[model samples]
Target: MTDQPVTYSADSRLASIWSAAAASWLPPITLILAIVVAWEAAVRIFSISSFIIPAPTEVAKSLVAQWDTLMQATLVTAGEILFGFVVSVVVGIAIALIIVRFDWLGRALYPLVVLFQNVPKVALAPIFILWFGYGLAPKIGLILVIAFFPVTLSMLAGMKSVDHSLLLLMNSVGASRTQILFRILVPHSLPSLMAGTKIAATLSVIGAIVGEFAGASDGLGYIIQFASTQLDTALVFAALLLVSVLGVAFYYAAEILERIVVPWRPKFNDA
Candidate 1:
């Protein structure tokens, strides 16, 4: 009798990958479907008015009916989110670097940063609208304010938490401050930065909506406001659904970017 090693064929490997992917997604999808079903049943049994609490089906119908308007608003909101998030990343990283490089600056500015973060973002939204008017600028500014802290804090923590032994080794090698920062600290900080960026991405959406709510003629937030005025609860629900989808989509996009940039880092499942 001879013994043979078992090996997976290419098709088998692909099938396994697909199965794993499906298994990972199935539970969440099932839960969402169950909730929708229950919601539909409850609305029908209670004879609920669409003006009060629209069923998922009504929301879906509203989505289709208002697709054009929703898409235009979505584009506007998405642009604000992307632009604001980018600004937040650049400014956050620069601030992080400055604070890390200067002990005095870090000591002086860190407290102010924490204090600023403690301020209610919603309160600031109206002020931003007042300053920047009912334009994209205010929404972008609000998003930047809301999204900035997480990335900055993450980066600072990451840079500060680098192994002291590594710093010592770099010192032994006579590595310059810039070299140590670029080669060691920045790389070490990427994982934390990405984590913060994911959070910031979601927050940016909320910030934009808040700004729109404060003062805007367009965007999902405006749609929600208008729908409420019209008592079109289905439209409100539809817009809310779109916003939720947008936030999740943005979050996953950041996650994908993180994976691309930090390929060496373990994935969420692995961790």
Candidate 2:
């Protein structure tokens, strides 16, 4: 009546909102909630013993009740992961630089790198525990081993991916090696490095847990082992949940850092 186009109907607006919400999170949330409900129902309906498989509610209760202990274990695990991850980044970058700097070194050592990378980190867990002793050292060492290869490989690939024309342009300008590396090579490699960091973050947690499982007196890995031995299924679930949260949190933290550092990376309109 006012000569303006009609607005969307209430139903249409509601549907639009619902669609957006669903697009944002409903699928994953529904799936997770459904799984939890199913898990709880299965345990109750089958009369499963808590010692065998705990209900989700029971695990949540256990987590709440054992908050202090779980928190301490979580802190220890986080410390180990952080230390290991830092070490891996430093060592990985150093190795990548050496390989990229010297062609002879790359040719000579790349095969060994591939060979070691192929070897499962779990296989070396025991050896690391043996060498570093049954302490945080072994756990951190294994974390370093697990995370380092991916970072090194990703960085090397990134460095090599620099455009030939760009390289030539830098050379034409007689740019110093350090200047070219800092301005062009590093920026070009940032996306790859972030991807590698995310993978490394997850693997570092696994490595720390495996090392601790081998032999350790503290941390989430130790808590999991202790829970298993006592048949505390709820506690085991609690530990696993904590580990999952840790991995996700670390991954997203890396992603945030990547976004902050690499503004050139494309941002989606939806995002």
Candidate 3:
């Protein structure tokens, strides 16, 4: 009798797990299917020309036809995003640490940071091209500029959120500033850091594409420009899909990293 109840309970738990998984995945899958069907039907029913708007099937064909070229461009753009995002994280953390350590410096430099943050990165692309040329340097520079602010802001918020009593307690124990930063502040700020990273991921992609738009030998943005000029609307759509995938991939990567680094983060399950 005891074994029977235990086995039944285990089965119920497994069923619940499966149900939750399905619930989480079903809505997005259904929405994507609906969009694809509506798009295809609208194009066929309206006698819409493929030049103006390619149907989902037409986009799929272009994706297959130009897979090699698109993949090459994607690889270049991915390298720029990854390299620049990593640099931004490092620089952002350093800036946040400095801000937390010195109140006077943070106050003085924060306005300057915010000022530069508001400057449209695309508007400065020409200057970057003139200065850094058509190489990856300009794209990397743009990505760094666009992505770092959120990280710095998030880290500062997280550190500031730490309890004042904890700080006083540490001071009473003669803990050094460096020790407090590493031992207390860094750990506390990790969740906020990851949240900023997720935001930065999408911005980094935009920055890279905008940089490519100004001047690039090759990238998804370049492909989009060339395809549009050639009236290959399907190809443009195909490139756009790849760009979306890249942005989603980076965002999910940040989410996964957060789960690994902050396993104790709160979860909100539906009632």
At residue 233, what lDDT does model 3 achieve? 95
What are the Cα lDDT values of the candidates?
Answer: 0.92, 0.87, 0.90
Cα TM-score per model: 0.93, 0.88, 0.92
> Which stretches of candidate 1 lie above 4 Å from their native place?
1-16
- TM-score between model 3 and native: 0.92
Q: Write the per-residue lDDT of candidate 2 for residues 1-271, one digit (tens) a residue.
A: 5898556788987887778877978789999999999999999999999999999999999999999999999999999988898888888877887777777997888888888898888988889878989877888889988999988899888988998999999999899877887798877888888778888888888988998899899999999999999999899999999999999988888788878877878645223
- Model 2, residue 114: displacement in angstroms? 1.0
* C-alpha-based local distance difference test score of model 3: 0.90
Q: Give the best candidate by TM-score.
A: 1
lDDT value, candidate 2, whole model: 0.87
lDDT per residue (tens digit) for residues 1-271 in model 3: 4555333477876787789889999999999999999999999999899989999999999999999999999999999989988888888888899888888997888888889989987798889999999999999898888899999999988988999999999999999998999999999998888889888888889989998998998999999988999999999999999999999999888888888988878644422
Ranking by lDDT: 1, 3, 2
lDDT of 1 by residue, 134-193 (tens): 999999889888999999999988888999999999999899998999999999999999
